[model samples]
Structures are given as structure tokens and as C-alpha cells.
Target: MTLTGVTVQGRLNLSQQHLAHGLLFRDCHFDDGVDLRGAVCEELIQFVGCELNDLHADNIIARKGFSVVDCQLRRVSFASAQITEDLRLSKSRLSHEVDHVALHGPNMVIEKSLRLDETWITGEVRIPFSHVGQDLDLRSAHLDNGAGLALDATSVIVGGQLRGDDGFTARGEIRLCWGRMSSISFRAAELHKPGGVALRADSIHVSLGCYLDQGLTASGTVRLVGAQIDGELACTASTFTSASGAAIEAERLVAKDVYLDRGFRADGVVRLVGAQLARQLTCTGGHFENPAGDALDLTGITCTGSVYLNQDPQHEQCFHAHGRVQMCGASIGESLVCSSGLFEFPGGVALDADGLNAVGDVRLNQGFRAVGRVRLSRATIGRQLDCGASSFVSTENPALDLTGLVGHGDVLLTSGFRAAGQVRMRDADVSRDVDLSTAHLEGTGTKVFDAFGLRVGGTFTFQLAQPPKAEVDVRFADVRRLNDSPSSWPTRQTSMEGLTYQSVSNIPCSGRIEILQGTKAFSLQPYRQLGKVYREASKTKEEREVLIAGLRDYRNRGKLKWPQRMWNLFLEHTVGYGYRLWRPFVIALALVVLNFPIYHTAEHHNLMESVGAKESQEHHNVKHCPTDFPCFNPLAYSIQLFIPVSNLHEVDKWVPDATRGWWSTFLLGWTWLMIIIGWLLAAALGAGLSQAVRRQ
Candidate 1:
């Protein structure tokens, strides 16, 4: 049937006509095109499928049905096809250059699936306020248009993406339940219906921009896994409040610039795993509440610009970044965490752990704090293993563990480690002990190992197997050092290998004090205050005696004076007092002679009296006492007495006794002669004296 230029316009009823014809039904006035719809048509009805070509019949009603199922429509015309029943055109192949088809019906049940896949619809497709009685399944459909795709269904269900880039806008529910989309743009959209619908488009490559409005909810999960974007994606003011919850998750969402400025929230989780964002990612104020899982995880993400995740007081993370993550925030939790990522001014990092803190341990292995410095001001670790083992190298004076650390367990600084800085343990509160053995230190600067004011349970040991040869000021309080040795410490020589107890003041306490072997110079003020001062050289007995003597001398003098050499003699020794043999004897003789007076008296009496008194007494005539004392001689006395005066007492009693001895008689005769001579001599002497007085 090749009917050309034949205008049969009003309700041409040719049901089930098998024909191969060029039916030019152009500009014809028909309520519907040749109603061979339910007929078994074999050949193609060759006519451009267009209505309103003639524009005459305004109400050509084909209220039963219209079907061109599996038909090849070459050219046809029912331009303004008005119908009261359904119109079905499933699996039809129609040519281009067809327009102005207004199929007016309430329920246009196009129940079979449409195959617009790979078909390019250059113009617009609008299906508003119409009810597809069954589900409109357009799975894997492709739309290539310059403008967009619009569907304003109040409530509809599809198995796939309501997708277009000119921007999708929905008022009621645009429910693509458990479906996917390549891209979606809700620019200036008014999407508000709530069966709690979702738009899951994981691995969707979207271009330009995407904007989400408020009152738009989601229930099922959403994913943009491995999707790339080259525009600014904004979710500024949206509320995701669902019971089952939705997650806007992206495993590797590569984007240029992403912004969530102050009004974006998540009821579930937001996973940004291994995302390579090449711009700034900001999230200033939002509440993330996922008690079971992590609240916000951005692990292995590399951001080129500044990233911010600061929660306001009203909104917070219950679990907080509770997974293995790394984020360069302008303020980490509160302050800025700037390492290799871009950052601005200096601010402190605050880690609050009241709601959902990590109860497990943390291992700061190599590359842990490798980029920049970390400051832990008031942190308490339940159990932490931070062995600073040469992983950190200080370009300047790095502030490693400043403030103080409080631990219930151990903190090890093991071998092959070097801290070319001061380890300030000032005011640290620890429960167990601390060990610093086989460590190395050097340089002339003041290095401190301060553990003062610590309330510890056990002792602290610094007895290293191989310690460094350095000078350090260790100030420990109520902390004991246990060492025992006999040699001298703080000495010049190194062989004094033992322990010592040196008190700055003599304050009574327990435990010993130890200085290492190579300590060059130190002070033991008021040397007597030390418990024991030892030297390796043994002392002799003489030196001990000299030392005792000097001590005694000092004690006697009440105190030791300056110029210590006065007491230094107590340190030397000698054998004897330096003397010869007979000298002692001579001294003994002199002492005896000066001691007693009896011998001198006896000798004097024997020599003088024996030579004078005894001999004179034995002679019995008072013979020669000495010229010192005069004695009387009887015989000579008589002779001289008579010679002095002849009239010896006037007469003589010049008579001699008759019974006298011979000597006595002779003495009497001599006395008579001497009496006569004495009288004559007396007369001469008296005459001489008288002549001399006259001459005078």
C-alpha cells in the first residue's frame, strides 16, 4: 500500500494491515494516526511520525489504545494525537525530524521497557504530572542533549538514574531505589519529597557543579566511588535525617575543589578513603554522629591546600576521627595541624577525649611524627610505646615531649637512639621506675636530666653498662641511687672505681650518690661531711699516726684555720724523734745531781770537819782549828802569860802544883820563866808606849 499525497486525516481505521507503503499523512487533521494499533501489522507504515501537520482536528479521540509495537514507522502524522486510553510504543524504531507530538492522557501506561539506549534525543523530554501505572524501567539508558532531562512525578519508582547534567529538579519523590547514575546536577533544584529517597551514584563521573538544597533527605547509602570531578561541589545547607541512615561515601573521590560551609551534616559516616583532592576541603560546622563506626575517616588522603575540620560547640563528633587517618586541619580538633600539607599561622592542637576516645594503645614508630613537631601538653596515655629510636632528626631545637608526660606503664628510650637535646622530666608523674643505661652524651652546654618532684613507687637506676662521657646536672628528689664501691669518687684519677655519698648539706636520708668514672671536676664541700672519702692507694701506719696527731692538734686548737698545709702534716709520717744513744744518759745524770741536797751536805761535812774539827779534838790542846776559828793552847798559854807580866796576878802564884804530870811541871817551870820574861816585856812595852805618847 504505497499511498502518496493522499490526505485521509480523520480517524483512518486500518487495523492489522500488512503494508509496505510511503503513507504521506502530513498536515492531516486526525484525532489519532491510522488506528491499526492492536492489529497484526507485518510491513512498515512508512510516514514521518508527526502530529499537528494539518492542525484541523482538535479532538480526534482514539480512546481505546495505540500500538506500534515492533513496527518500523518510516513516516506518519498524528501530530496532536488526543487519546483517553493508554498509548504503547514499545520496541519501535522511528527516524529523526519528528516533532510536536502531544499525547494527552492521564495514565499513559508505557509498561514495556524503553530502548533509548545509545539514542540521541537532541530536543527536550518533559513528562510532568503523568502516572506511569507500572514502573518505568530505563536501565542503562543514555541521554545526549544540550539542555537537560526533566521529570516532575509526584511519586514514582524507577530502577535507575534520573540523570542529566542540565540539572535535575524534583518536587515529590524521585525514587530510584537501589540504582546508579553517571552524573547528577541539582542546580537551583527544589527537591523535597520524603519517602526518605536516595540517589546512589557510586563511580559517577560528574562535570560542572552540584548543589543540594535543604529539606532533602536520604535513607539508603550513597557512594561516589572512584569518581572524578572538575568543579566546586557544595553541600552547604542540607539535613540528612534518616533512621536507616545514608552515607555520602567516596572511596577515591578525586576532586578539584570541595566545600561544605557550615550547614552540612551526616547521620551515618563519611568515608574519604585514599582521595586525592587537589584543592581546599573545608568543613567548619557540622555534627557527625556515628557511634558504631568512625565519624570521619580521611586516611591516606593527600590534600594540596588547607583542610579544616573544626566543630562548633553545638555540633561535635561522637567518635571523632576514630580510625587510622591523617588530616591537615587549620586547627586539628581545635588548633592547626600543619606538617607537609599547606597551613597558616601557629596554633595549639587540642585533643579532647570525653565522648569516644581511643582506649587502645598508640605506636609511634618510624615516620610517625616525621614531618613537623608535635606538642602534647596535657595528654594521658593508658599504655603508650614511644621508643625514640633515631627516627627524629632535629634541624633546630626540636620540642619533642614538652610540658610533661603521665604514664601508668613504661616509656623506653632504647638503643641506637640519640637525643642531642635536653630531656626534661621535670614534674613527671610515673608509677614504675625509669632506666637510662648505656646512653651517650657530650658537649659543654648544660644538659638536664630533671626528675624532680616526681611521686614514684620504685627506684631510678643510672648504672649503664656503657654510659656516655658527658657532664650533666641530674636533679632527683626523693629518688634513690644504689651504688657501692670503696674507692674515691669525684677524684682526679679514674681508677677510683666505686660509689660515693656526697651531701651538699648533711641532711639525713637513705641511698648512695654515684658519679661516673670520667667526671673531671666536682666539689665535695667541707670534706668531713662526706660519709667516706676513698682513694685507691693504701695508707701506711706512720701516715695514719701523723694524720691522728694533726687531728688532735687541730682539736686542741678548737678549729682548723686557712692554708690547709698546717693540717697537712697530719697526712705524713716518720719513725723516731731523731737522737743519739748517750745523750739520754747525760740528761739522766744532770737530773739526778740537781734533784737531791743530802750528798752535797754529806761530802762537805766529811771533808771540812774531818780535816779540821776531828784532828783538833784528837790533839786535845786546841791545836789548830784553822785560821778561820781561834782555839786556846794550855802549855804555850802559861809561858806567854808569865812573860807578859812578871807579877802574874802579883806574885805567882808562881807556885806549881806538885801532883801535876811531867809535862805539867815543865809547863809550870816554863810558865815561871815566861812570867818573869812577860813582866820584863810588859815593862819595856809600857815604857815604849809612854815615850811614844811623850814624843807625840
Candidate 2:
């Protein structure tokens, strides 16, 4: 039956009717509505240029297809309807003022496509639990539900692509929760909900891919939480703006790859916490602006390929984030690069990748700037962590924190890298070199570079652009080799105690001494470590110098008792702490030469007498020789008195007499003092000779 320019006064109810031919209404106006409840049509049922109050097609079955093209309706209900072919509602205007839903299509199954191209709906288009065999095309469609859901396709399964691109606009939320589609594309679509969710695709499974890119704009949150996409989830050149909350919440979303790059912008947070991606996550040239909170949060996300938050070379623009860009606990299969990107979160963490595990290099270098702290604490990087030429500026906290990081390759913070606050790498273990050459580090706290307990498998290059103004703590850190300049060493407030290194760069012993002395506290370990390095290199002279300096410093600066201080001083001056073995012999020879004059003066004053002729009370001179005893020679007497084990017997013949005069009394005390001095000198000589023998 075909009706043209016909007017129906009452309801045209076709309930429980079976029609062999399709019904076509052209330019028809119905006063009430058309009801096709429980009706079965063998051919196509079409409505063209028709004006109706409602179209209730509940439980209707169309064998060919269903079409409502270029129609004006207040409400349309196709609940539990089955269409064998395409259901076309193109260029239709559905305005339901009383009801919240303009088109209700729950449990509707379409054999082919569901095209709503250029259609305008004032109320919600509720199509929950619907199944479409082919594409669900909503191109150039306008949906307006005020603040309510504009399009709710929950649990709807589309066998083909679901496209809402090319001027498709939804004023309220467009939900696709629990829906499964082969692919989804919202390119150039505008979804606006202001403070509410604009696009909620929670747990939606897209077999091929999902594209919300190509100038797509979402004013409110675009949530894809628990969504699984077999292919890439790209939002390139898209804009997401949420003033209150996250712009894109994709927690636990599993996708092949994610692209939010090339002029992509998010006004609020773009949270992808716990998201799993089979490939890379590229955010290059994207601008994320959430000043009060995190801008892009990828916490616990796993991506099999590299993550690029760097500059787009073609556009010469970087991935700029105003708030914190957190990637904490993320496991990346390849490198995490943010080269030439600007992350500004002033006073807070700008880029936090703590606990991040990356299989390849992490490049935050090449003009990458973080206004706040860049924390990579506990992160494990498989390849080099190159932060060369990067600038991290934080006034209140550490500028760059790499604590507990395990890096398999070199960590380069070199080549004009600047850190305004402290750069802490405490407990970090790097398998290769950690280069900080030409880097500028300024501390906000006491320590400038705190690498305490850090272990480096290769050389640690600390050749900075300038000396750190604050303390540099490397206490207990184990480094294979150290390449640093003496001028780069912090003059004071350095804590290098227990820091172990196999070798150091070629510097003077005095320069190395300055390093040990520049430590905040006096520790013997620093001295011993320096000495060990010199010893290992077989530089015995430098080793002795270092050891002697260490002893002197310990005596002067270290805590000691008065006796210990005295003993330390004695050992240092006498034998250079047993390093100078010939010093004692020189002192013994000088003492013997000075004692010769004292014995001669005593004999000249008649204060000396032969020991055998003591009863005769005679002075022992060369002229007064005793036959039974040895000759009373002054030189022989002095030699015998000075030598403790000499058998000259001159001391037996001649001795100082104290009973002669006052001068004689002083001479008698001096002669006995010489005997005691002789034994001490002999003992010192024996010790020096014994030390030399042991060394040989």
C-alpha cells in the first residue's frame, strides 16, 4: 500500500497484522501516530517526508529493511524489533518534548547497517542491548538531550564499524558501555557535556581500532575505562576539555597502540592508569593542561613499544604539559622518550615516572625541561637513561630524583643539563656509566647531588660545569671508576664517606687530598680509599703521601686523647708514620756528635775521673792513663757513652765525678742522661732497620 499526500485523523494501528507488501508513506501527516506492534512485513517498510507524533514498532519484524528517511517525528520506538536489512533514518528530525528519549531501540537487531546520517534528535536516543550486523553510521548527526544521555548504546554490538565522524555532535553524554564493535571512529565529532561525561565507552570492545582523532572535540570527560581495543586507540589532533575532572579516563584499557599526539590537547587530566597497550603510546606535540593536578597520568600502564612524549619534528612542537605528567609503575617495553618536551608543575612533581620499568632507553634529554621535580625513583631501565641537556627546576623539592633506580645501561645527565634543586639518586644501581658531565645542579636542601648507596658498574663522570654550591653526598656509593675534575668538587659539605671506587681520573695527589679534606666530616675510609686507589696503581710515593696526609689529618681533626695525640705526632715526625725508615738513623748520628763536646768539657773541669781510679780521685785525661783500665781518651769515652752496646771500656776508666764542684754536679747528671739517651736511640735505630728489612 502506498499513501501520497494523505492525512490520517486517528491512530493507524497495525498491531498483530501480517502484510505481504511493504507500506510506503510519502508526504503523509498523521494526527496521532502509526503503530506496527507485532506486525510482520515481507518487504521494505518506508517512510519518506512523513510527519507523525510517534512510530511505535514494538516487536515488529521487517524481512527486507526499515527506513524513516527525511521524516519529522516527536518519538520513535522500535523496541524488540528485528530488521533483516538496513535500518535507515537519514536526514530525520526526532523531537520528543514530553519524553526523555526521542528514539528508543532496546533489543533491536539489524541485519545490515543502521545509518542515521544528517539526523537531528532533541531527546535521548536510547539504543541499549541493540545488535547491528554491519556499520552503525551516525555521520553529520546532531544529538541534544540537554544534560542527559544523548546516545546510550550500552551492550550494543556492531559487527562492522561504528562511525560518528564528520560533523557529528552530541550535546549530552554518548555512552557505549559494554558495547562491542569491530571499529569505532569519531573523527571531527563534537561531544559536549561541560562538566559531565561526554563519551563513556567503558568496557567497550573494538576489534579493529578506535579513532577519536582528526579534529575531534570532547568538552567533558571521555571515559574509556576497561575498554579493550584490538588495534590502535588514536586521538591524534583531538581535543578533550574537562574543567573539573579527567578529560580522558582510560583506566585498565587494553589497546594495541595509543596516539594522543600531533596537536592533541587535553584541558584536564588524561588518566590512563593501569592501561595496557600492545604497542607504543605516542603523545608527541600534545598539550595537556591541568595546572592544579596531574595532566597526564599513566600509572601502572604497560606498553609493549616505546612511549613518545617528545617534540614532533614536522611541526616543531613538543609535548607540553602544564601539570604533572605521571607515569608511575608503568612498564614500557621500549624507550620512554620526552625529548624537547616541557613539563611544568612548579613546586610539585612535573614528570613522575617512579617505579617505571622500561626495556629500552629513557631519553629525557635534548632540551627537555621540567619546571618541577622529575622523579624516577625505583625505575628500572634496560638501556641508557639519557637526560643530557635536560633542565629540571624545582625550588621546594629535589629537581631530579632517581632513587632506587636500576639501569642496565648508562645514565647520562650530561651536556648542559641543569637541575635547580637537589638531584637524588640514592640507592640507584646502574650497570654502566653515570655521566653528569657539564651538568649544573643547584640544591634547595643541604645536599646538591645525593647519590648515597648508589652502585655504578662503569665510570661515574662527575665533571660538572661548575662546583656545586651545596653539599654533595655520595656516601656508601660504590663506583667502578670516577671521572671528575678537582675544580668540580664541592669545596665544603661533601659526604663521600664509605664511597668506594676502583679508580679515579688522573689528578694530582694534592687535588685528591683536597677532596678528602673537603668532606663534611673526617672519616678514615675516604683516606683509606684514596690510598687503596694509589696502591692499586702501584704509585708507592703517592700512596705514602696520601697515608701521611691521612695520619696528620686524623691527628688534627679526629677526636683523640692527649697521649694519643702526642704519640701520633711523634710517629709522624720521626718516621713519617713508618714510611720514612732512615729518619731514626740521622737523629742517632746527630746525638752522638753533640755528646762528644760534653765529655771533653767535663774532663777539662776535673769533673771526670777513671772508674778504676775513683779511689785516687784523679781526673781522667789523655795524660793520666791508667795501665789496668782502657785509655782515658775523651773521644773514646764519648763514643762508649753514646753507643749502648760499645765495648770501648772508656766509660769504665773515666766517669763524671759529682763531688768536685757545683759544675761537677751538673756534669755528673749529664753523663747519666747520655747513657739513657744512648739506649733509646739504639732502640729507635733497630726499629727503623727492622721496618726496612720487613718491607724488603
Candidate 3:
């Protein structure tokens, strides 16, 4: 039956009817609505260029298909309908302002595809529990339900792809929660539901992949919580903007690969916490801007391949972020390259990757810049951590924090790296060299570089362009070799206590001594280590000089009582801390030469007398010499007094005549002083010789 250019004033109720032939209507107008409840049609039911108030086809069976092309309808319902062939509703205008549901297809089963191409829907299109065998294409469809749900395909199953690409537009939320589709594509689509959810596909499973890329724009949040995509989830060149909340929320999502790169922009937070990716997560040349909150959060994510947050090589565009990019507790199978990326979160953390575990190298170098702190504390890197040519600035916190990090390869902070705040790497363990050569670190009245308790397997280079502005703490740090320059040493304050190094670079002994002296606190270990290094190199002269300088400095700087201080002073002047071997002997010769003149002058004044003829008053000079003893020679007397263990009898013959005058008395006292000085000189000389021998 076919009707054209006809108008029916009353309702056409075809309930419980069975028709073998198809029904076709063209240019027809119905004032009421048509009801096909429980109707069975063996052929096609087509409506072309028709205007109807409502079409209720509940529990209807169509063996061939159902078409509503280029039609204007207030409401359409195919609830629980079973259609063996395709259901085409192309180029239709459906508006239900009172009921707010333009098309309702709950529990509907279609054996073939359901096409809504170029359709205009002003109310909700509810299709919960619907199943389609083939494609459910909505290409070029415009769905507008104001701020309400535009399309709700909850629990709907699509055997083929669910496409809404090529100029598809939706004004309200489009939900596909718990839906199972072969694949989903929204390329070149625009979804606008500002300040509310634009797309909610929670727990949806896609067999092939999901594409929201290539000029796709969403004005509200796009949530994909617990979604499972067997293939990649691509969002390349897509734009998502949320006024107050997250732009993309994909927590616990599982996908093979995730691409949010190449002109992808998110105005709010893009959270992917606990997401698992089988392959790479590429975000090259992406822009994430959330000034008050986190821009991109990937906490606890596990990726099988590398994560690229770097710049685009083809376009020379950098991956820029205005808020924090948090990846804490993330595990990556390969490297994490963020080279040439710019992250700015002033006075807060810019890139926080604390406790991250990556199997390959982590490259934050090559012009990478962060306006706030970049924390990687307790991270485990399998390969090198290259931060060369990077710039970090944080006024309130550490610029780069890598505390307790364990890295297997070299940690390079060299090559024009600049940090305006403290760079802390305390307790870090690196297998290879940690080079900071040519780097500049500026601090805000705190430690510039704090690496206390750090352990390095290779050399540590501190040959910076200039000395840091603040203190540097390396207490208890152990390195294989130390390569530093005097000009680069922190001049203001430094803490190097318990620092151990196997070897040092080529620096003068005096310069090395100055380094030890420049420490904020005094420790004897550095001096001993320096001396041992010189000794191993067979530089005896330099070693002696270092040892002497150490002793002098210790006496002056070390806390001690007056008695101990005096004893140290005496030892230093007498023997040069046992390093100057000829000091004591030279002093002994001068003492003997000066005292000879005093004895000879006493003899000429007749102040000397013989001890054997004391009562007879005989002078102890050469003229009145005693025959029993050696001649009373003034030279022999002077020499004998100096010798503490001599067997000469000169002292037994000579005596200062105290009975003659006061000059004789003075000579007697001087003789006694000489004997005591001789004993002290002999003891000091013996001690000095023993020390020198032991050192040899």
C-alpha cells in the first residue's frame, strides 16, 4: 500500500496487524500519530518526506527494514522491536520538546546496520540495551538536547564500528556506558556541553580501537573510567576544554597504545591515574593548561613501551604545560623522554615523577625548562638520567629533587643547565658518573646542591662555570673519583664531612688544603685522606708540607685547653711535627757556640777556681791547671756541660769561684742553666729522629 500527498485528520492505529506487503508513504501528513504495536510486516516499511506527530512501533517485527528518510517527526519509538534488515533514519528532523525524547529504541534488535547519517535530533535519543549486528553509523548527525543527554546508548552492543565522525555534532552529554562495540570513532566531531559531561563512556569495551582525533573538539569533560580498548586510544589533534573540572578522566583504563600528541590540547586536568598501556604513551607537541591544578596526572600508570612527552620533530613544537605533570609511581618498560618540553607551575611542583621505575633512560635534557620543582625522589632508572641543557627555577622549594634515587647509568646535569633553587640528590645511588660540569645553581639562602649520603660508582664532576651562590652539602657521600675546580667550590658554606673518594683530579697540594680549610665544620678525615693520596703518589715533599699544615691548622682551629695548646706549639716549633728532621740538631749547635764565649770570659776575669784546691784559692785557668785532671780549658768545660752522658772529667776540675765576687755567682747560675738546656735538646733530637725513621 502506497500513499502520496495525502492528509489524515484522525489517528491511524494499526495495532496487532499482520501485513505481507510493504507500506510506503511519501509527502504525507498525519495530525495525530501512527501506532504499530505488535504488528508484523513481511516487507519494507518506508516513510519518505513525511511529517508526523509521533510514530510508536513497540514490539513490532519488520522482516525487511524500517526507513524514515528526510522526515520531520515529534517523537519516534521502536521499543523492543526486532528488525531483520537495516534501520535507516537519514536526513530526518526529530524534535520532541515536551517529552524530551525524540527517538526511544530500548531493547531493540537489528540484524543489520543502523544508519542515522545527516539526521537532526533536538531531544534525547535513548537506545539502552539495543543490539546491532553491523555498523551503528551517526556520520554528519546533529544531536541537540540542550544541557541534557543527547545520546544514551548504555549497554548497547555493536558488532561493527560505532562511528560518529565527519561533521558529527552533539550539544549535550553522549553516554556509552558499559557498551560493547567493535570500534569507536569520533573523528572531526564536535561535542559541546559546557561545564558538564560531554562524553561518558565508563566501562565501555572496544574490540579494535577508539579514535577521538583529527579536529575533534569537546567543550566539557570526556570521561572513560575503566574503559578497555584492545587497540590504541588515539586523540591526536583533538581539543578538550573544561571550565572547572578535568578535561579527560581515564582512570584504570586499559589500552594497547595512547596518543594524546601532535596538537592535542586540554584546558583542564587530563587524569589517567592507574591506567595500563600495553605500548607507548606519546604526547609529543601537546599543550595542557590547568593553572590552579594538575594539568596531566598519570599516577600509578604502567606502560610497556617508552613514554614520549617531548617536542615534535616535524613541526618544532614543544610539549607545553601550565600546571603540574604528575607521574608518581608510574612504571615504564622503556625510556621517558621529555626533552624540549616546557612545564610551568610557579612555586609548586612542575613535573613530579616520584617513585617512578623506568627500564630505560629518562631524558629531561635538551632545552627542557621547568618554572617550579621537578621531583623524582626515590625513582629507579635503569639507564642514564640526562638533564643536560635544562633550566629549572623554583623560589620556594628545590628545583630538582632526586633524593633516594637509584640509577644504573650516568646522571648528567652538565651542558648549560641552570637551576635557581636548591638541587637535592641526597642518598642517591648511581652506577656511573654524575657530571655537573658547566652547570649553574643558585640558591635562596639555603644549600645549593645537597647530596648527603650519596654513592656514586664513577667520577663526580663539579667543574661548574662559577661557584654556587649558597652552601653545598655532600656529607657522607662516597664517590669513586672527584673531579672539581677550585673556582667552582662553594665559597660561602660547605659541608663535606665523611665524604670519601678514591682519587682526586690534578690540583695543587696547597689548593687541596684550602678546600679542607674552607669547610664549615672541621673534620680530620679530609686531611688524612689528602696526605694518603700524596703518599701513594710518592710525593714526599708535598706530603710533609700537607701534614705540617694540617697540624698547624688543627692547633689553631681545634678546641683544646691551654696546656694542650702549649704542648702542640712546642712540638711544631721544635720539629715541624716531626717532618723537619734537621731542626733540633741546628738548635743544639747554636746553643754550644754561644755558651763557649761566656765560659772563656769567666776564666779571664779569674772567676774560675779548681774544685780540688778550693781552700787554697787557686784559679781554674790554663796557668793553674791541675796535673791529676785534664787541663782546666774553658772550651773543654763548655763542651762537657753540653754532653749529658759524657765520660770527660772537665766538670770535676773546673768550678765557678762564688767566693770571689757577684760576677762569679752569676757565672755559676749560668752553668747550671746550660746543663738543663742540653738535656732538653738531647731528648727533643732523639724523638725527632725516631719519628722521621718510622715515617720512612
TM-score of each: 0.30, 0.94, 0.93
> Count of backbone clashes for each model?
25, 2, 0
Clashes of 1: 25
lDDT of residue 115 for candidate 2: 91
Cα lDDT tens digits for candidate 3, 285-319? 99999999899999999999999999999999899
* lDDT score, candidate 2: 0.89
Instruction: Select the stronger candidate by lDDT from 1 and 3.
Output: 3
Model 3 / residue 150 / CA error / Å: 1.1
In the predicted model 2, the residue pairs found to clash are: 610-653, 611-653
Q: Clashing pairs in model 3?
A: none
Misplaced by over 4 Å in model 1 are 1-183, 187-197, 213-215, 311-696
RMSD (Cα, Å) for all candidates, in order, is 31.4, 2.6, 3.0
Expressed as tens digits, the lDDT of each residue in 469-527 for candidate 2 is: 88899999999999988867777688898999999998899999988887788888888
How would you order the candidates by lDDT, starting with the best? 3, 2, 1
RMSD of 1: 31.4
